[model samples]
Target: MPAITHQQALDRLAAHQLVQVIEDDVASLTSTAMSYAKHDQHLTVAGYVLPRLLARWNCVLNASNDEATPLYRDKTVLALALLLHKHGMTETAITKRALQAIDNLNAAVALSDAFFRNTDAIKALLNTPALALKKRPSTRDSLTFLRAQDVVAIQLEQYYYAAYVHEISGFNEYPIIEFYRARFEHRPDMAALQGCAAQGETYNDGKTRISLHAVCGMRHVPDPANQFHLIATGITDQPDQSQLGASVGLHTISNLFQLQGVMRKTGV
Candidate 1:
């Protein structure tokens, strides 16, 4: 595949669309990022390079892991850890030790899962707190609170924001349409799609337990025919606009990978 510029990736990411990084199609990108060091194109490589790649891979791996469900795969977890280390995020001794453990294929799945499931350890590695609310400062916005059920409702802020851009920009808008279409409708494989939907189902229209189904579940499917358009109807408001935006956007993609790891289990 032909290489795309950093600008292209940023545009796709900012616009809430998929870049080549997640799909297996970005072999060129992987090589390109790697080449920065060898080709002397980048000076010691900016922190963004690996983080961006890890973030993208994290999304895919997170989704895949979630779908694997009651049986989280060891290879998948370890592979992602190694990928993260390749980037520059592995600073902690705990992470280094975990990475070493994850490298062992003969390691017990239960043991590996237990290590990854350590809420405090994973949080320390990521430099984020273990509390879901503390971690989700942005998600609290655009979520309406329903007192009776202890639920949080999301009004789909990013989708609407992107849709507005699509309507106004009106340039190659079909890709944007196809993006959400795949997310809300054109589900991917059963395991992945079901996991995505299940992830979404975890949250409701309440402030306490907002769902981030969009980030993990939304699979950007290919559609040659520009058939889907943004739904002009159904818009609701949730609190924590910026936080939710960060989590849903490219910035928080890596965290999504770890979300299924410990946070879900310990309710942190």
Candidate 2:
């Protein structure tokens, strides 16, 4: 990197506040997007540096401890695996960790399920977590009321933006992928995702309890032994649209990832 560019990156990382640091990234991405419009080199640089960035992020995750659902960790390693196809110059650790996450996918999910079921497991899973489980109200909607199982998923979102961008961004893209393939003309089933907020079993067209139904689902594993299933076609209206457009084309529908479009629970 040139002196000016290197200094800029340092400055961005140097912000004392978290939001400021994010602003720096947003500015950098916005600039990168503008640069990409004028030259393909910007995009090429992004692709080349993505794995290295992901690796650094995984290192950050490894520095912490969390015994709950390893979904974030799993997603992180899987993403790194996809980007890092070859083992070279100390990339072996990342590859090994990522592969291990893949091999243990089923065990991880099962453990998470068990963690939710047992009271002792729940206590063990919390490094320091805030759990909010409201009983299903009689007159109120079930969609807004998270199930007891949702405690884990809520924790998944607690440090969501900070901790698991790679996994969330990568696995969460499935809904939009299917939505596009279907021409975005109809709603798809999203309930297959189990506790997913996008699943149609949650709600209907009403704004108070809008549903994010899944239209399609498929295994997104690195290998057959590890089945990393991804479901898509749920809808939501929250996401950073400017970031999405700057990163790629604008997606009108909000899927589970809230990045692209998700399908409605009911067929159109």
Candidate 3:
């Protein structure tokens, strides 16, 4: 894989439709502050902004095509967190609002038998390590909320990277697990990667060699059979599979890895 320039990466991110959506939403949310000022009322991040953001995302998720449902839902949650933070919401408040959105969406999915008719499949999807949203501590009043916020922030970063990859790669249908596994394999030092933002190593999936960014923010566990399993939280309902070894796109891997580094260094 060849190295890309920082300008190139930023340009791609700027051109991405998801980023555009986020920017527009941020602008709109900021404009709402004017209305609050006029009414002599303080803007409520939790009670008002959060719910409105959730509703908009609910509509986005509901309107998503079946094939892109997982990607859409994951990115929507990430986008929601970004918007809330941009509006000056606290970490605790963001965690509570994000968890509420996740629960509501999961409940809605549970109600729909069409999404997963088989009980075992539904259980597998919902019980997967990646979908373990409830595992994060719910004590929003304590220091634990900070920990929860950190975990959720990392998860959101992973989702954002995945969404960026999906969009730039022309929406290829690779398994989410494999995508993260590839990311884990190419774990680059995020601090250094941010300095360049365009450098990556070529990954060979035995069949083809593709340029991939050395992104971070994914957690992994040892798998006896597969060597490693990516802990792809907040990104997909798909269970990990030993059979998936497909190669993702060049720009997909390159940009995500670089963005991960940026997120880590800036703590954004």
Best by TM-score: 3
TM-score result, candidate 3: 0.28
Better by TM-score, candidate 3 or 2: 3
Q: What lDDT does the true structure give each of the candidates?
A: 0.27, 0.28, 0.32
**Model 2: residues >4 Å from true position, as ranges?**
1-48, 67-71, 83-92, 109-268
lDDT of 2 at 54: 38
**Model 1 residue 82 distance off true place after TM-score fit, in angstroms:** 4.2
TM-score attained by model 1: 0.26
Better of 1 and 2 by TM-score: 1
Candidate 2: residue 49 Cα off by (Å): 1.8
lDDT of 3 by residue, 96-202 (tens): 44445444545556323432233233222222222111121111110110111011112221222121121212122221111222222222332222322211223
Better of 2 and 3 by lDDT: 3
**Model 3 segments beyond 4 Å from truth?**
1-15, 42-46, 62-67, 90-268
lDDT of 2 by residue, 193-264 (tens): 222222222223332222222211111221111211122212332222221112222222331222211222
Alpha-carbon shift of residue 206 in model 3 (angstroms): 73
For 1-268, candidate 1 gives per-residue lDDT tens digits of 2133223322322222332222221232233344555667443332334444444343333444333431233333333333333333342443454345443432444343434344244334434321211110111111111111111111121111111111111222111110111122232222222222112112244332223321222222221011112233222222223322122232222122233332223211
